[model samples]
Target: MYVIHLRYTGALAEIDDALDAHRLYLEQQFDAGAFIIAGPKIPCDGGIILAATMDRDRLDAIIAKDPFSQQRLVHYDIIEFNATRLAPGLNLPQSS
Candidate 1:
């Protein structure tokens, strides 16, 4: 699994300007089953995304296509971790 942290590098106006395109990209990822959960940060400085299991390289490539990334409006930090524990009712793919 992975957690993606995005920090805006540009002004809020620029961020707002790209929001629609950004949302479209997010929707596509969700439809492709790559993203689990995503939303803006508490302070609205950026956003967070929880992703399904996948290679780091593949994930990086996917993020590279995001509108924010393309415009260089945000910085990305990717963290990978084993799902040693899960909440009830949450079904995550397990390694064989």
Candidate 2:
């Protein structure tokens, strides 16, 4: 598993226009099981974190399609890390 850290660095004016498309893209990725989790940073800091259990190439392609990336509303610094999953009552699937 890996985490993609995205930092938005642009005018806030573009947010309303880009948010919907960005969300749609993420939804598609989630449904495809490529994205395990994703959400925006609170406090309106223009940051987002995405947990992906797929290859960097595929993830890169996915991000490339986001409205934020396409419209220069945000930029990303991807970090590939080792993830460990532990749970008790949660029935989450094992990480690939």
Candidate 3:
């Protein structure tokens, strides 16, 4: 799985201006099964996205398509890790 941290690069005004498009991008990714969960950061300066395991190249391509990237509104840091433990109700792809 992956943890994507998004930090605002542009001003609040610019971020707000791109919110709609950014949301649409998120919706698309969710629909495509690329994202598991996503939401804004508590301080409202950034956001987080939990994505399903996938090829690194593919994930990078997906991230590149985010509206925030296109608009230069945010910076992203992606972390990939092996999920050694899962909660009772959690379901995710397993590593061989």
Candidate 4:
């Protein structure tokens, strides 16, 4: 799997406009089973984490479509993970 770290860098005024588009993209990815979970960072850190498909190319494409990226509101770092364990309720897939 992969974890995407999105760090917002633009004006807060654009948040409401960008949020809906971001959520829409995430919802579509989730429905396609390519996304596991996503949410904003607490403490207003201007960041978000997204658990996404394992494929880097696919992840790149998905990130490219994010409103934050389109609007130059945020930058992202993609981290690939090898799931060795998962806690209940996290809904992560069992490692093969």
Candidate 5:
């Protein structure tokens, strides 16, 4: 699994301007089943994304396609880990 942390580096105005394209990019990832879940940070300063198990290079390519990355409005910190457990009835990949 992967944890994608996105922190805004630009002003809110710039962030807003790029939000739509960013969302579109996110939607594409979801459609491709690369993304599991995502949302804005509680403080709205950034966002977090949970992604299914996959190659790091593929994930990096996906991130590079993000509008925020293209516009230089946000920074990404990606962490890869193995899923050790899940809630009852919940299903997700467990391998690193």
Candidate 6:
């Protein structure tokens, strides 16, 4: 699993301008089953994304195309972890 944290580096106006493209990018990722969960962080300063297990390089490439990234409006932090445990009925991404 991976946790993708995005911290805005530019002004909120810039972030807002890129929001639509960012959302569309997320929606496409979800459609492709790349994302498990995603949303804005508390206080709305940035965003968080939970992604399926996969190659870190691939994930990085995908994130590099995010509108925020393209516009250089945010910084990305990726954390990878093993899913050693899960709640009942919760399914995780299959390892590639």
TM-score for each predicted model, relative to the true structure: 0.94, 0.82, 0.93, 0.82, 0.94, 0.95
Q: Better model by TM-score, 1 or 6?
A: 6
**In candidate 5, what are the lDDT values of residues 1-96, reduced to their tens digit?**
999999999999999999999999999998888999999998999999999999899899989899999999988999998888889999885433
Instruction: Give me the candidate number with maximum lDDT.
Output: 1
Query: Which regions in candidate 5 have their CA more than 4 angstroms from the true location?
Result: 93-96
Candidate 2 lDDT over residue span 13-68, tens digit each: 78777888888988887887777777877867566555656667777787888888
lDDT value, candidate 2, whole model: 0.74
Please identify model 3 stretches exceeding 4 Å from their true place: 93-96
Model 3, TM vs. native: 0.93
Q: Residues 1-96, candidate 1: write the lDDT tens digits.
A: 999999999999999999999999999998888898999999999999999888888898899989999999999988998888889998986421
lDDT of 3: 0.90
> What are the per-residue Cα lDDT tens digits for candidate 6 across 18-70?
89999999999998888999999999989999999998888988898898999
What pairs collide in candidate 6? Answer: none
Sliding window of 10 residues with minimal summed lDDT for model 6: 87-96
Worst 10 residues of 4 by lDDT: 45-54
Q: Report how far residue 58 has shifted in candidate 2, in Å.
A: 1.1
Q: Pick the candidate with the highest TM-score.
A: 6
Q: Candidate 4 residues 3-57, lDDT tens each?
A: 7777778888787678888888888877777777778788664665556445677
Question: Which residue pairs does candidate 2 place in steric collision?
Answer: none
- Which one wins by lDDT: 1 or 6? 1
